[model samples]
Target: MTDTAPSESTAPQHDALLADLTTIRVGGPAHTLLRPATEQELIVTMRDVWQRGDEWLLIGGGSNMVISDEGFDGTVIHIATRGIQLVSQTDTTLSLRVQAGESWDGLVAKLVSRGWAGLEALSGIPGSVGAAPIQNIGAYGQEVASVLDGIDFLDYDNSEFVHLTTAELELGYRNSVIKEGRAGVVLAVYFTLTASPESTVQYQQLATALGVNIGDGVPVQQVRDTVLALRASKAMVLDPNEPDSASCGSFFTNPIVPEHIARALPADAPRWVVDDEPVADVVVPLGETPAPPPPPKPRLVKLSAAWLIENSGVNKGFRLPGSRAAVSTKHSLAIVNRTGADAAEIAELARYIGACVLSRYGIHLQPEPVAVGVELA
Candidate 1:
């Protein structure tokens, strides 16, 4: 796809470069940019682009992407549609159907203000609601996978609108079926939130910050405030004046490895048990009570990528020779564009970090963002 004249769209302009759209501010120009204001209009645009056999990309807030300096040689669709409707409400439960284009943090703030408790822990996260489920976005031990109930999307194979349930989405830790490169375009997302004044503090750090124990309930608004403050301290929140905020959040996800591999790492390395192998249940004869099973052994472990990077001797604010990219000063896991860093510099820095971790601990850290044309070779 080459640059062409502006086509009919809700928001159409000349060749808008990806650098101007992405949060990191590094990518090259895109062939074309299209923003649709309504679901019907977005569908029509998708169909038009497909029928014409043009390469296309769907961009939301552009928070979790790394495009190459060579730019994307395709049409870019920006989901600019916006609306939120309370689909259902009960004495204890409330359901919201939000447009994919709505800002994620904005939605969380709105819900928390109304005493909804499910998304308070996810406050201050960047990107759009439509992009949430694709990555099963999570923070502070609260994942969108828990609150997300359903999604309405334009199916890639038939160009027809389809609604899928949470189970069908197959959400996992920062992943879902959509991440497999499916062509479904999320038009809206349905979330079921608890109509409660308080939310459970599942994460240890968050609990400690709130002066509470794990599993304790804290006011929803307080949780949101605490989460935002925590994010700001790490420079994870977007701030134009803060150079460390110019990043794609955490560069690498916490690596989930087998228990044995995690045990091989240093004892000081932070780790969390993800899951354990199921133990066999005790069977009983008819009308008899069944016995409890023994404690299961942990089989999966979530290792801290940040710990690995720091322990590998890469300090915060580390940069390659003559490169504009560096690790965020406040957070070891983030890769920031220090001085108008291009995609190459970012990729180089990421490669160096990964190599360091691998050489030190034999664990290859993988990047979390979706790289368009740039790759960490």
Candidate 2:
């Protein structure tokens, strides 16, 4: 892979408006756009952009981002390449290598169609394979972290490609080293999936939808369809005709807080205790000896952002005075572009909602999307 000019064979139309490129549809224009069609081209293009000291943004399906109305003043690299290959296979597991730009849900659909069982519960997510591991994307109790094998990424500062194992990425719930800006641009990703034809049903909502109990197994395609239906109901799927779908799927992540903080919320508030580690109590017979009690458990809890927002007095479809952006009619977690709103309008609405939640619950809500000059303050 030798360095060269950005390949025109795959470049997006010059200076495409950020609003047009992104799902949120509220940003301004990008100064320059380059879409690389191959991994080598992506590396060379990014290297050239970096060497020139020009600010650059890497975008895939643009589902989880909010750009400024003033637009980016530098180069924007739009990953457009696509490929998926079965890289390795074992008796019980299969490894598939996919380029950065492959659609996330599309990949899941393809895998499920083939009777692969690791990604069925994540069926309706919108984004790219490269972007999935950055946030450790998850849904319905299934996360990209569980299936991720490794990633081929470029180290811009060193102008070299590096292969990173899953452990090195430090994947946690809705986060990873890449999300923290430690890793460079992702060129490709590898996923290891089970050979079984049955998919795991770990989320209660999904299990209920599928008429099954948690921990039960179902056909992978059935799981995928059920997940997709659940997502579409909340306007989570990207559909141009659906006004509520013009926003990023979820504006804020479900807040993870200490157990005490979670306990302070209303009794009916949606909260789940997440155990960071498991400790089995060891019992010793009285005649023999006494074993010391296990160390105190770490108490962490996940709170629903939607619940917090609604409890804070912002109802679904709520909006600030004279604002074009509003909460989605079908989901309180989304901040939709209700009326061709600009980035500022959306940012203002987000701040208002956040303030409301903070004032009422004493807990600040943080946005999940990557903002480029779009201030939530």
TM-scores of the candidates in the order shown: 0.93, 0.94
Off by over 4 Å in 1: 1-12, 284-298
CA lDDT of every candidate: 0.88, 0.88
lDDT of 1 by residue, 181-217 (tens): 6776999999999999999999999998999999998
| Superposition error at 80 for model 2 (Å) | 1.1
User: The CA-based lDDT of model 1 is what?
Assistant: 0.88
**RMSD per model, one decimal:** 4.1, 2.6
Inter-residue clash pairs, candidate 1: none
**Which lDDT tens digits does candidate 2 get at residues 161-195?**
89999998899988998888774699899999998
Q: By summed lDDT, which 10 consecutive residues of candidate 2 come out lowest?
A: 6-15
